[model samples]
Target chain A: MSDHHEDLPPFCHPVSTKLLFGVFFGLIGLTILTVATSALGSALGMPPAFAFPLAMVIATMKAFLVCAFFMHMWWDKSFNVLAFLSSLLFVSLFIGMTMIDTGEYQPTIEAFDINNLANVEVSE
Target chain B: MAVADSHNTHDDHHDLYDHGEFIAHHFDSAEQQFDSGKLGIWLFLVTEVLFFSGLFVAYTLYRTNHPEVFEQAHVFLNKYLGGLNTIVLLFSSLTMALGVRAAQLGRNKNCSVYILITMVCATMFLGVKAVEYSHKWDMGILVRSAFDLTYTHPTPTTEIGKSLHISDYLVYLCVVPALLLAGFLVASVISKLVNKATLAKFMMAMTITVSGYFLGVVIGIIFMNATEGETGSTHASVIVEQPLMLMASTQDDHAADGDHEDGDHDHDKAAAGSSHDGEHADHEEHFGSHPADGGEASFDAHHPDPSTLSRDVGIFFSIYYCMTGLHAIHIIAGIIALAWVYWRCLLGHWRTDYFGPVDYVGLYWHLVDLIWIYLFPLLYLID
Candidate 1:
């Protein structure tokens, strides 16, 4: 699974400078794309439902490139990769379960906002 | 790639005993020591991810609950500055990865050079963050309980109009870097005079890294001025009073005063314009509008009252600071750790069998970059 160089150490997985710069430029390009997508998406009246997720997906792609290449995960042990992915799984679970209960109190926030707006008009 | 010739230097490459001091006796071989440390770093990263996940959870919850707050407050965040920082961090991550590769090949010179570049990037990141944070604070964008987005400080009544200048904020940010720069110069000179080549070289690298803060400050100010040229120094008071003047002209007072007709016209368009900026750059008739600016950013034209539109924006900034602030702290910590690696690299402590420190630190640095990948889009490019 690893590159076996007689002179090189077992844990060492030296990356090519070309690949490093390639990832760097790729990240910069994706950054510009993201900014453009957000700008163009709203200008074209794309809904948040679509626009937000689209941005997140791009961010995830960039994150993957950083981990797999810059962090040398592609040559890393499987055990380490599993540990990292599981942490993300737990994060998703944590955010998901907490989110389900939030819907119940959402109306209270809307009610307060409406009540406050009424006061502003009356004062003016 | 430059290390492809490392095999030719095999004769000079130190044997395993040279790396013995770095590896603890508990480890049987250099390979075993490296494996244990690598595993340990990955575990630490898992915990770091979970720690940041808590903040991400807060962000998602609030954003879902009150989307309007995010949409309104996010406009105040200058995406240009954020984008610059993102580029800086990504570039740093590249240098850090190269440094690790250099260390693995036992090229201390290349490794130190790369680590130094990474350090400069870290400081530059903080310098930009300082500009962003202080600018928001001056505008009274703060956490809940202290949130007052509408606090428009009267422009400093001086010929210089120095108050709220982005440069003024930058000076505060540059204080430590400037002192460090001076100290480094002095130390470098003294070390060289004392025939301490190693210490002199180390100090020189540090001087260059600190200078990066000054570089960032310059970029930060240039960006701030470009975005809201009307908000710097002398022009600031004009923007502060722009909204009130715009409000008064709505009563159909046009042409009543022929002398003021030209100035009034500019205000009319600025106040009426879709996003609240009408640049009559050619006309400077002591424009009735203090500075046809700062009726404020990307405001909703449909909702005339700013306070109402800014409702719950504090919640958004609160989360913004918490997430980005913690991330900045990590960057600072990374710099501290990089300083150690820089010292060790200069001492030529890393060889093919003992580059664990560089590798571990590079992993940590990449995590910082990873968080910012999510932050730039989520915070600056809010839908």
Candidate 2:
């Protein structure tokens, strides 16, 4: 058994630069897409709130292309992808909780009457 | 297509082949060494993600307090440039992946070439961003204390418009792009310069490009602040009245005039309350030593509603600088790391079993691109 053993062959060929350049131009194209769609979204009667989100969604697509193709996350280990995803989930949760708190916290504007000069504090 | 051919095995299985002095005596085979190396790299990358998380949290808290300020300030950013950079980064990432692939197949020459191309794309991305940022400086958009208050609130035609308090967004935007580009360029130039076999006159060109950006930003910031300081005075009344207009304009259509009446009533109540206080003071002072000093002319002569415009403006640009500025720092760091990897590759230092450092850093480079995707919309695409 020692005399006859099976082992993985050393990989000898790596990727080429041509494909990398293709990714580069692709990113440029996506940037153009982001600019065009964002402009169109603003002009197409959408509210700024909604329009901006939609534009972000398009940008995210471009980002995904870079991550998966250029960054080679698609070819990397599954664990790396998992690590990235979990971090994103945790960040989203943090943002969500803070936004909730901010939305609920009553602003102090109601406590002070603008006309009550005696109660007002001014800094020169 | 024979079974005998499929069962073929190599002779190098159990035999310890001593090839060089650097090989660790503890490792059994090259395959084990390679996989472990890659694993070690991924672990290090996890730490990097955690580090960046701190900055991201800061952004969320500030954004929540002043959504409108953040929104208005974001409009001042250049989405086209950011989007283009994102694309450039993504393409570089792809090239990086291909480079790794080529390495795995034992094509060292091909791997080095791919890395060089990736570096070029990164350079181009930075070049575009530099041009875009120069324009912003010309427009007086950096977040120093004396930036122009050109972005007036739409409704506050009477008072001041809503400005967010987050100050770091603009800084994040400018710094991140510049940093990423500079880091990559430096890494490339340094590695090439150190190699005596390939050293040439190219170092001078690289030095010029690096110094040019530094000088430009310093001058731009100084000039912008000076101009703004000279003509920086804003009308306070506008700040106080803009919110009221926004509130009036956004009310239900059927109750539009009703809301307007209510708002006018509130304004009158505010005025009446002020005058009432002034009168009350006059009466109360009759019993005091300063009774004869009850002349209300001094108080009433210059009563302008304390403008919140400055506060709003300050808040808006603050977040603007923080968010974009933080992101910019990350970009610069990523560029430096990428450049380092390219340098190693150029020196023929990496082999199929030890490119994990390059691979993981590329992972991070992609994240910088991802963040830009979100920022471009949040800042530049505002309607």
Candidate 3:
């Protein structure tokens, strides 16, 4: 309904078909990368444990593709990006705290018998 | 019916109630309230991810000490089924994103179509998973007794198509958790039915119940496959001497022979037993265990060995369950949101100017599908 639609930024308009096509191919490329990395790791004798990280890295890349384009994160308000990033930050904190709590060590302590010190003088 | 404007008597309408000015005496605009709700949702999702992360980390430590167990277990998962689920979820994500786009553009008809497509894809993913799980169950693959391990389908050598790729140990770990998830989903559905909830609740309950029954059948088949003497649905015991059965097969000859010298066999058995204990202690020891193993064994059993396994394994299953369960939960939530949106859409509450809630829900739905895209491959496919 506006007379000067040309004055508005491109992002404010509908996304271009080329960009949609790019997303499609990018998704395919990412999937290939995920499979390739996983196969490479396994072929190199990496265990099942390594497969997860490889898969995760691949997943992160694929998710980035969807988020940046399909989800329109690239064109979203900076505030929205900040909000989403905050969630991720909290997630990191959660993982870190769990690791720390689970990783704590309880060392064994023994009482020294000083009453027999004369018979066995402490030798360093 | 014959109401009159009372203010007209004195013509003092300036003292009228300002409905617009009433802001519940709390927040600013409606947008601020909505933004706060979104923030709350994000915070909740973060906590959810964190909770699953703990499980992942625990799995990682266990895998480190039991590399063989992890490797052997990995084979039990059906990569093909997982890949199919991945593709299904990826497509669902696309549909969900399009649905959100449709809502943002105020195209309610298009939004509905896209959402329907998304729901279909989700259903398909669950369906394929059901088939694969059933195959495992029919094979007697669910981890219950160690006796299940001794039974192997002879076709793995001749017919490559029917090869049992999954390891016995992994079946217990992965399939058991999967069954637990199925049970939870069913429980959620039953709880909804008990509440005598709305139409959206009924639809969701129907979906989960059907899926749950399928899952239970699949699990039952896997248990059946493990039994030797019985047919498809029967549980008749296959009469065979336990020790002799283990011995006749050269595969487990080492288990029966125990022929190593006193020191070496003792060391090997101890090492194998200790590593197995460290990784899988959570399942058995967490419940109950006799105080027979030495002090070190008992101590390590009580304290999960997080230091030993690859951190990613724990992270994988952690994300696996969280992503899948969260997505399933969201599917149900989306149905409820859709029901509300349906009411609003029917009422013409949305137009070209304001359709943010519908659009945002669609965005969240896309996210749910997106997470599953990764989960399928990480859990089911990649060896």
Q: Please report the candidate that would top TM-score against the real structure.
A: 1
Isolated chain A: TM-score per model?
0.79, 0.70, 0.64
lDDT of 3: 0.46
- In candidate 2, what are the lDDT values of residues B145-168, reduced to their tens digit? 434333221221111111422113
lDDT of 3 by residue, B55-111 (tens): 455444444433333443445454544554566567666666665555545566666
Give Cα-based local distance difference scores for all models: 0.73, 0.49, 0.46
- Please provide, for model 1 over B1-383, each residue's C-alpha lDDT reduced to its tens digit, 9 standing for 90 to 100: 12323233234443334335566756655777888999999999999999999999989887875675676567677888898899999999999999999998888889999999999998888877877876777666677535544334334444333643443444565677889999999999999999999999989989988888877776776777686564534224333433322222122232322223234345533334212222322111122222222112213333433223332465677789999999988998998899899999989998777899999999999999999999998999986
Question: Second chain of candidate 3: TM-score?
Answer: 0.50
Query: Per-residue alpha-carbon lDDT of model 2 for A76-109, expressed as tens digits?
Result: 5687677756766776776676667653424343
Between candidates 1 and 3, the one scoring higher on DockQ is 1
Give the candidates in order of DockQ, highest first: 1, 2, 3
TM per candidate comes to 0.78, 0.60, 0.56
Q: Give candidate 2 regions above 4 Å deviation.
A: A1-29, A107-109, A112-124, B1-67, B105-113, B120-140, B144-147, B150-195, B198-306
* Candidate number with greatest lDDT: 1
List DockQ for all candidates: 0.44, 0.29, 0.19
In TM-score terms, candidate 2 sits at 0.60
